[model samples]
Target: MRGIAIRIHREFQLMDCASALSIEGLVLEMVGAATRRRAQGLSVRPSRWIREVKDFLDEHFKEQINLSTLAKCADRHPAYLSQVFRRCYGSTIGDYVRQLRLDYASKKITHSTESIADIATAAGFYDQSHFAHAFKIHTGVTPAEFRAATRKK
Candidate 1:
């Protein structure tokens, strides 16, 4: 991880009013150190496949994203890609993409005054209905209901 990434994460934790030196924070620090040590000062790591997949997802989240295109992007067999992705992220690619889109939508919904339809489209769901289904499935409430509740807060 970049030093800036670590710093920003620590700053965010502090801003959240959590302990800067909590057990979880300490464990994350140690894990990061161990990872750096294991790299053994190697530059240009062997992350071609995963990096390719991540880039593809980042650039193409708004379309009809599919596993076949991702497998092709990584230049790996579909099964291998699926297995490797699960090992790295503890979730299927579909679930990972959905989570990412929902996270993006949530940030927009909270931070901006965009209409729900616009937010849904911006978050990569092709249509409002699909976005509604996904939002409700993940958050246990429709987007309208979520916005309403947040207003109450």
Candidate 2:
């Protein structure tokens, strides 16, 4: 009976150790999941960040603005800023910049007497051909054709 009691006590101690280990494992898992969720939450931002990015873009669209520069201005990582900008604005940063340039070019095409090449250059396009291709893609007309049409009326 004495031996049997000692064996039972040892068995209970072992079970207690096993239970403690199981609880510790569960606690660690819960902590890990919480950390992951917090990290994911941090990636999301308020609309103000997007507005800040848009304001910066509006100011610098005529210059060569890239993701890194925009991110720096916004105090965000490039990838994170890109993600938030797209989510809030429904367009990529590059697309937004391109649209701004095209919009500026269109205004120039209609209101100014500058040549298409010079307008393209002023709008931050690398050259006339590149501008024409991009313009056609966006506006469904070449820059000259669009210019002539706008000038007609």
Candidate 3:
């Protein structure tokens, strides 16, 4: 579990989204195993922790988040925190963060005259290229293309 957390954290810091997502899948598998074990005994409800983490993410999605910091805040191990979050929320933390960033960028694209690079930076992307790649993947269009298409509608 620690190893998985470490790998995911490393990939995330390097901005390797694909690697982070792949490692998160491993975390989900561990979560499934842990769930089965807990089902065999007394299962403690993690509703409060889940809610706290979700709220925190919702508020700070634009910030550079560290799993260790979040785990410490929630008083849980990083792996356990991620496992519980994925199990309950149906998405990895990285995916949720990216979705938040993309959602913000998309809104700015459609509603404002800000340049794509400016919007990307404001949305917490490391670079315009990375933002464009993610935006294309999410919406099937580059940021400029998306803007043009939306403007024509």
Candidate 4:
């Protein structure tokens, strides 16, 4: 984990658009390893309700989502759903949704010639600026930089 952190730090320092994909991959790898380690210590599996909630989020992450609506769908209290989701996934529902959106936007940015604003809207971002902010936070580069960097590879 420490080595991953160090590598990520080095990548960030470089701020090379081409390495952005590698950085995202490294981050995912680190998160997966951490999640696995956390899960291994647990004695019980995640509940079916939690799994269902996760599935719902996976499918609807690009759409408007809220805890109350998810709570109603799951037949559970919002607080309970939030708590269980965090316990099972080590991340809040909102964080998970944002990650999904970012992942989708990154792929579109890299694979298509669409305008940034268009891709942002398609990815469920309210506007280009918001998408750029989130994209930079998640990928360590702006959409244009990511696109240019990936294309250079």
Best prediction by lDDT: 4
Predicted structure 1: lDDT: 0.69
Residue pairs whose backbone atoms clash in candidate 3: none
Error of 1 at 31 (Å): 17
**Each prediction's TM-score versus the true structure:** 0.64, 0.68, 0.70, 0.76
| Model 1 lDDT, residue 81, Cα | 92
- By summed lDDT, the worst window of 10 consecutive residues in model 3 runs over 1-10
Over 4 Å off, model 3: 1-46
- TM-score-based ranking: 4, 3, 2, 1
Tens-place lDDT digits, model 1, residues 42-148: 33343667767867776777667888877886788999998777655445778778777876786677678899999999898888899999888765568887676
Give Cα distance to truth, residue 11, candidate 2, Å. 86
Deviation (Å) of 71 in candidate 1: 1.1
Per-model CA lDDT versus the true structure: 0.69, 0.72, 0.76, 0.80
Clashes of each: 0, 0, 0, 0
Which candidate number has the best TM-score?
4
lDDT of 2 at 43: 37
- TM-score for predicted model 4 compared with the true structure: 0.76
lDDT of 3: 0.76
Give the residue spans of candidate 4 off by over 4 A.
1-44
lDDT for model 4, please: 0.80
